[model samples]
Structures are given as structure tokens and as C-alpha cells.
Target: MPRAVRSPADFWSGALFAGFGIAFAVAALAYEPGRATRMGPGFFPFALAVVLSLIGLATLVRSWLRAGPPPLGLTSRPMVLVLGAVVAFGAMLHALGLAAALCFVVLVSASASSRFRWPRALLLAGAVSGLSVLVFATALQLPIPVLGRWLGG
Candidate 1:
């Protein structure tokens, strides 16, 4: 009898995780991974890769052991919109500044949802922008401007 996948989604997800983990692990090997006490540049990446690979292996095993929901069909709309939002964020960061770029990103990304609402999206954008400014600008002291040249900052 031919073997069949119990959970297609889990199987694919596991494959993706394992692939990325392996790739990153290999790349991490380029840098010296020091001991736990004195971790080198590659230590963190290597550690994360190991964990990810283990999780992927476990998920792959589980996929064969238990049934799960049907695999979801691909949808291009959300993907395109989300990718566009990222590109927009990058482009607008310097021109529009961090806060405005973040807000635009939020609005554009939120629009990808079927149940998107302008009001809710706006609120979320404000909150995210404010928190990002506080964390990245104030706390971390990054040089990202609050308002860019276009915004008269």
C-alpha cells in the first residue's frame, strides 16, 4: 500500500522549517561559534537553527502520526499586498520618516484582510507608530527621524 501524508499542511510547514534551518545553520558555520560563556557572532544563529531544525523534525513526525485540517489553497492577493506594504515601508522610511512610513505600512497591510476597517487600522497604526518611535528612537536612540523632509521636519 502507498503511504499518504496525514497532514499536508504540517508536512509542508515542516519541510520549509527544516530547509531554512539547514540553510541558516550552514551559513552560521562561516562565523566562529564560541562557547556559551563567550558566544561568537555565529553562536546565536547556530543555536536558533538547531532549535528550528528540531522543531521541524518533530512537526514532520507528528504529520505522519496525526491527521489535521485540509491544506489551505494559495491566495495571491494578500501576499501581493503584504509584499507591496514592505516595499512601500522601505521606500517611504527616508522620505516620509519612520512614523509616517509605519502608519502607511499598517494601513496598507491591514487592507489585505477581508474584514479590514479604516478606523481600526488607523488606531492600530497610531499605536504601532507611537510604540516604535518610543522603542527605536527614544529607547534605542536610533537616528531614524520622526518626520522626514517631506513632512517639514
Candidate 2:
């Protein structure tokens, strides 16, 4: 008889990482990667892909050697909420601008957790929005408006 799967989590995680790593590596090849001392646009991504692939391979091998609990069933609520938050952020970004988009994303995503609380979610949203503004607007001076034209910018 065939051997039973030992560690489903490790196996699945490894497969996912390896798949992403390979995809990234292939995509990075389209750009020119310079030598390590003189990095090019593709250099960092290619290097990271190599490291990720190695880690995934190690994880896959380990799954066969170790015993672990069976993989948990997928839940739709958290997945839907988190994905919806990302889509909402993208859709609202141009109209509402970065700060509002960040707040929406944070609050919506926070609700995905079973332990979500209004106070905590609001606090987290405020912190993330402030930090994003500080980084992207004040520090980086990105051209993105703090408030969009729709908000009387």
C-alpha cells in the first residue's frame, strides 16, 4: 500500500512556496539581472526566489520525515473578508485617497478575526492610516493626494 501523507501542512505550504518561487524566478528572467556587486532590477527578486525555493524544498523533505496534524479545513468568511478588503482598497484608492483606503482596509480586515473589537479595530486603523501617511506622503513625497478630488481635494 502507498505511504500515508505524514505532514499535510508542511507539504502544502512547501508546494505553495515552491510554486510561487518558481513563478517569480521565471518572471524575473524577463528582466536583466546584473552581477551581485552591481545589482539590476531583477537581481533582488531572483535572489529571493532562489532562497524561497531552497526553503520550500527543505520543508517538503521535512514533511516526509516528521508527523503532523492533518490540514485544517478552509474557512470562507475570513478569506472573503480579507480579499474583499484588498479589492475595496484598490477600488477606493483613487477616489478616497490613501488614508481613507488604508482605514477601510484595516477596519474591514480586522472584522475577519473572531476576536475583533470596535475599540481595537479603530485603534489599529488609526495607527496604520497615520503610519501610511507619514511614510508615503510626508517621507516619500509620493504624488498621491492625501484627499482625492471627490473629497474636495
| Candidate number with greatest lDDT | 1
Global local distance difference test of model 1: 0.90
> lDDT of each prediction vs. the true structure?
0.90, 0.88
TM-score of model 2 (CA atoms)? 0.54
- In model 1, how large is the Cα lDDT of residue 119? 95
The C-alpha stretches of model 1 lying farther than 4 A from their native spots are 1-3, 35-39, 71-74, 93-153
* Residue 39 CA displacement from its true place in model 2, Å: 30
List, in order, the clash count of every candidate structure.
0, 0
Off by over 4 Å in 2: 1-71
Per-model TM-score, in order, reads: 0.54, 0.54
How close to the true structure is residue 116 of candidate 1, measured as C-alpha lDDT? 99
